[model samples]
Target: MSDKRQQLIETALELFYQEGVQSIGINEVLKVSGVAKKTLYHHFTSKEALVLATLETRNQRFSQWLTVQIAPAKNNQELVEHLFQSLKGWFEDRVEVLGEFRGCFFINTAAEFRDSESEISRYCRQHKSDIKQVIRQQMATYADQPDETLLERICLLKEGVITQAYVAQDMSGPEQAIELLKGR
Candidate 1:
């Protein structure tokens, strides 16, 4: 039998990403997942708990997807190319892990959970930090030293690209980011 907890997370994650945490409710998750409310409650104490679980699962899968997508690069240039190429793939709906681009999930979640001290807000910050760590690790193989400034810029560029792509329906983001990287 399929795990009811995982089913809930997958269903809720899709709904929350497509809509937003504030917009989706527990009843919808139950209906979409076909898991009884009691079963959902058995695994999660509350909807907020379920949201956290969904974010955790998404973060894990996203890190793996990103790592694989950029793993083939041989140099900084290629790393940048691979990064943008991967983003282009996702933007084009080719990245299955991040079905249908809806801006960054963490960004969306953070926007809804504005209290910096809240668990959701903290989780969002941690997710971004982990992504930056991934970038640093990937860049380490090619660079002589860890470049914090470059790391920060890359993170910023990535955020901007996702925003532009999602908010403005601008698909030129990856190319623009690539060109911008070349200037750095």
Candidate 2:
């Protein structure tokens, strides 16, 4: 991507994540990104197109971050532990580029979009499925035969952690997730 296009995406992602998609205007994104209105329009046909691109950018970034953060796991137990640890670090703003956690971006987008048929909502669902696939891949490597139920349970725990930490401001959610993992 050109510098202008990349800057617009990054700026829009930050604003859309911090503020709701509907709350942040195109002009605001252009101003924050230091890109001209024509430049943004040239890169993205419409505000919805820009929003989709922003979602795509965030999905790539967040998935990669999660993968890197948990890459050191040596076993199933370690994998589970590292997953929670990553969440804790994210909740505490230890990830420098991510800043403070504002809940899962995909989840936030889903809630904002509401309509299941909407493009944004579809992207949100796809991002979530991709996350579950990542967990399944890791579990498969660590187990002789990974159970789908176990994979779902782990994903549930992760979602719970994100929700509790972001909504209730309960930092212990990751620890609770670890305990849930231990029981499994």
Candidate 3:
């Protein structure tokens, strides 16, 4: 991507992640990115297009970060533990550029764009499906076959932790997840 386009995407992603997609205007992105309207429009035909690009960018970055966090796991249990630890770090604001825990970006976007058929909502769903797929793949490492029940439980726990951490400002969600995993 060109420097101007990258700048616009980065700025828009930051603003959109910090503020809801509906609330952050294209002008705010352009101003913060130091790019003109013409330039932004040249790269993104519409604000909706820009929103799609921003979400796509975030999805890639978040997935890559999660992959790295779980890369050192020697087994499935360690992989799940590392995943929650990474989330705890995020909730505590330890991840750079992520800023603060405002819940999952895709979840927030999906909530803001309630129309299930919308492109933005589809992207949000795709991001979530991709995360669940990752969890399933990791779970398969320990079992001879994929265990759907365990996968669902872990994914649910992960989602619950994220929601609790974001809504209640409670950083213990991950620890609670760890305890839940212990009983399995």
The candidate that wins on lDDT is 1
| lDDT (Cα) of model 3 | 0.85
Between candidates 1 and 3, the TM-score winner: 1
List, residue by residue over 12-45, the lDDT tens digit for candidate 1. Answer: 9999999999999999999898999989988999
Tens digits of per-residue lDDT, candidate 3, 121-169, equal 9999899888888767666666677667767887889989999998888
Tell me how far the alpha carbon of residue 62 in candidate 3 is from the true structure, in angstroms, after superposition.
Answer: 0.8
Candidate 2 per-residue lDDT, tens place, 30-117, comes to 8898899999989999998999998898888888888887777767778889899988999999987676689988888889875898
> Which ranges of candidate 3 are over 4 A from the true structure?
141-143
lDDT of 2: 0.86
TM-score of each: 0.95, 0.95, 0.93
Ranking by TM-score: 1, 2, 3
**Alpha-carbon error at 104 in model 2, in Å?**
1.1
Give the worst 10-residue stretch by lDDT in candidate 2.
134-143
Per-candidate Cα lDDT values, in order, are 0.89, 0.86, 0.85
